[model samples]
Target: MGLVERTSSRCAGRAKAFKSPGAWHAAGFLAEADLSANAIERARRAAPAYIDLTSSNPTHQGLIFPVEMLRAAAEPYWFARRYEPDARGLLAAREAISRYYSGRTPALLVPPDQIVITASTSEAYGLLFTLLADPGDNFLAPNVAYPLFEHLAAAHHVTLRSYQLDESCGWQIDEATLLRAADARTRGVLIVSPHNPTGMIVQQPIAALERLGLPVICDEVFAEFTYRAPHTPPLAALHPALPVFTLNGISKMFALPDLKLGWIAMNVPAASAFGARLEILNDIYLGANSLTQAMLPALFEHGLAFTAAMRQRIRASLDAALAVLKGCPALQVRPPDGGYYLFPRVMCQDDEEALVLKLLERGVLVHPGFFYGCEDGTHIMISCLSAPEVLVRGLELIVETLTT
Candidate 1:
């Protein structure tokens, strides 16, 4: 069966268990076999070390932020420490985030009161899931998407309906498939602009989304890294009538994932109605640390230049990798509209698992498309976040193996 069918079957099974009082357990924690990871680990113990082309961690990719600047940003927090906490995060942090949104291309005015801070985007997802969905309610997500949504949904006892993203049409949302997937139980629609792995941005207007009348949860972590598109308009800015919750953080923006700070900016007057309940939920955990909240304003003040430099470096690496990969006749690659990942279709007849293993044997590691729910065709995901030389070398190895 396909990814959507499999997901539906699994969700149906999970929902049935929810009806029984004795069936309560950590079902989401169940692990499945990952053949590619096992093979890669085995390969690592042998002669040649594998060059990872799937590294997304900015710190590991030599994209470190200035330590002195970080220290200076947090210096004031050290001297004037207080334990006062607000459920919607610090006012200064929220105001800074408001300013950040207001300064975007088609500026969005997100009031500080409409923003709720979380420890990270993942945590924000968890909170939103709880806020929007009940035990058996569902949400719509793209078929070719990062697997985190599945896990988060499973954890909250919620189902995620799959919607197709047409690769032939530049990975745009298949509106028919999307509409068909939603039923009475679907509480929200999850949209990832500059989507992970595939890097397809939702540039067109979302008229189909308006018809559903459900809330929109947009992930914009890579909003600053658009390539073909001049800028990624915040989904909130595109449709003011639709209730949209925009999620972003400094992790991808400023290359500071370790700092662990993210937020949800609620748009539209209707979305703001949930702010009180959201505040109550946030107050329960108070997941965001006070120190990071204190440091946020300074980071925003001094980090724009750093983010611009990082975007340029990523663009250079992407261009170089694409130029080399396109030379290999066995691979059909397309330039992403944004972000630093290249999802190339493998024209070779080899099975996806076998192809990945073959690449690993030749000292390069990459992810198969199936890992990200791309079951329509055989594809591989490559990250261009590495240094230009390292990325080019890895791409050359992949090309050599596939062509041979």
Candidate 2:
């Protein structure tokens, strides 16, 4: 008691000197952020009955699941309480993923040894960032794609250089723009097929990726949800000569976001070298859970019906929303090539942020263009994954708000 009291008494005098506690180097990114978007705040406080055009989650959009099949798949974890851990995930789960790819439209034959599992695609991105780049290195990413890569790069102390996806050319990658943006410090390239918000698949000739000789990370989470364009082959499968890491997950693939399972399929012949280092990194974190890994094989084998049903709903909602938006002359609706989003450009002088707030005030919510690095004029992104009736009502509200 005497010793503890003396230590507390000495430290209490110096406690007044503590002003800024967030001294961690990695957390500096959070401190520099400008999160003063009133649109987001208003949307958060909107009434519970407000129509959400921004609903990206499939589980809440009224889709049936094979409950018994999922329950049966998870039963093994209870009986076989084996706590065996592998950095690359369970052998059976890896084999199941390999088989799932090998049976793809054109067949992408991936070896189990070349696969690394993670809790989510977000974690998979962290692993790839660590594997490919040093702190000062940069990666080239599509300018009009999802804003997530920016945050991920910041967290790892890596820079993300913007390469334009020309909207005039159907969101195709402008190779000249990419070359201009990249420098010697560039370590890799990220290509998101069925790009978020833009909805353009990377269908352009990418021989330049092999020429640049940097590793390519492709995100094909929305590959199967294609509607306007034909399903492009997996980037890793198409460019086997290059070091390609393809990321996909149960979240979008099986509409099981709650179950948290994702994978990195490395397609380089020299993957063994990368695999060894990756195993050590994964072992340090060991983020993948055993129950989900145990259930993957069954999910892959029996979950296609659920996926098909979800895709059907997405198409139906998309078609209905597009039909309604077409009648609104104040907007230009470019039907998404794929994915469950409809990113229509709102033709008005109003700032996109103001428009979003106005929409929120009218009991509807949508994202502004600049939120995804789009510097162009007013564009609001709406998701087609919502229930059809809700999507139609949201589209009507948008039309009414903008036309007035």
Candidate 3:
């Protein structure tokens, strides 16, 4: 067999053995940063260490929260007394979201009907997936964006294809590339605002997707954590006629992921047929973890302040990471638009796996860019919110390894 065929044939057997797309064969897995998983697991086996630079998790790294405040947010919900909010969500929680969005985009109110509460955005995506695309239909997405959608798509049994996001333009969407990526089989286009890892946002790429007459699934979980632009309204506001499913949750927004609260808001103002289907899907799932939904009103009013504080801390962390990158000649970090991580190319002798493995040995853990669907593996991602001191030290060790 030829080299390419031989490589594929060889890798195919190994690929089938992995649980789901993991670092090994990377076949069936979903979106996860196994860096910590790799570190903690391998550390027990080996115990070489330094600091971890790869984590976006709020709790483990300690983002500095008011424990009492978080406790109080869930307190009222505990008194539940058997009150469920129409399986849609409580009016009080919805109104708080409405008020927040209204302030963010005063020109319009997203009409709380547009929002359906879920236990998490993952559920929101699943709802949208079930509502629009059938099993095996293809979804077009950015070539270099978050990997979580891949896992979700796999679970939903939807095929995913990619269009390029121009790396040179601060990761802007390429309208032509998107057009080329979609066909009749394509059910939807998914976009992550201030995308994960790369941290860039697709500010001006939807016009093409709209032309195709396909629905758009916008994951705005990181919508509130922007750096360059003022918060943009959910895509529903831009093209009211287009069928759009906007997903967001408290996981990243408020840094209260432990709360297990999330939501899917359907914005198909122009397509009532599509809206009806989505509503039914929500009904099928009912509501996720009632107590978490119960905590929403309190979270909106009180926990939000903690989120604002976390954003400030994230900015500081981003600046520190950028500053460190300046000194590391072998590394180049692309400025992210609004997420909590930076994806940069690490100077590697071959692939980043060695560097990643080396970093783990040193106690500093991080994810290789290959984990996020980059065709090439020169990239490594570092969480922008890894505590200030730890991030600095981690960067120092990473730079040290690259140069030496």
Using TM-score as the measure, which candidate wins? 1
Better of 1 and 2 by lDDT: 1
Model 1, stretches more than 4 Å misplaced? 1-28, 31-48
- Across 196-216, the per-residue lDDT of candidate 3 in tens digits comes to 878876554368867887888
- lDDT (CA) per prediction: 0.84, 0.79, 0.70
Root-mean-square deviation of Cα positions for candidate 1 versus the true structure, in angstroms: 3.9
RMSD of each: 3.9, 8.7, 6.2
Clashes of 1: 0
Assess the local accuracy of residue 282 in candidate 3 as a C-alpha lDDT between 0 and 100. Answer: 72
Candidates, ranked, TM-score: 1, 2, 3
N/CA/C clash count, model 2: 0
Error of 3 at 344 (Å): 1.2
Candidate 1 CA-lDDT value: 0.84
- Measure candidate 3: CA RMSD: 6.2
- What is candidate 2's lDDT per residue for 1-404, written digit by digit as tens? 11111111111121022236466642565443434434365454655667877766777887646789899999988998889999899999999999988877568889998898999998999988988889878899987766678668867878888788887777788888888878999988999987887888876558678678788889999988887886757887768787888899999988888899999998865375477888888888878899999999999889988888888889888899999888888898887788999888878646776777778788887877766667766688898888899889988998888788
Off by over 4 Å in 3: 1-45, 78-80, 105-108, 268-271, 347-349
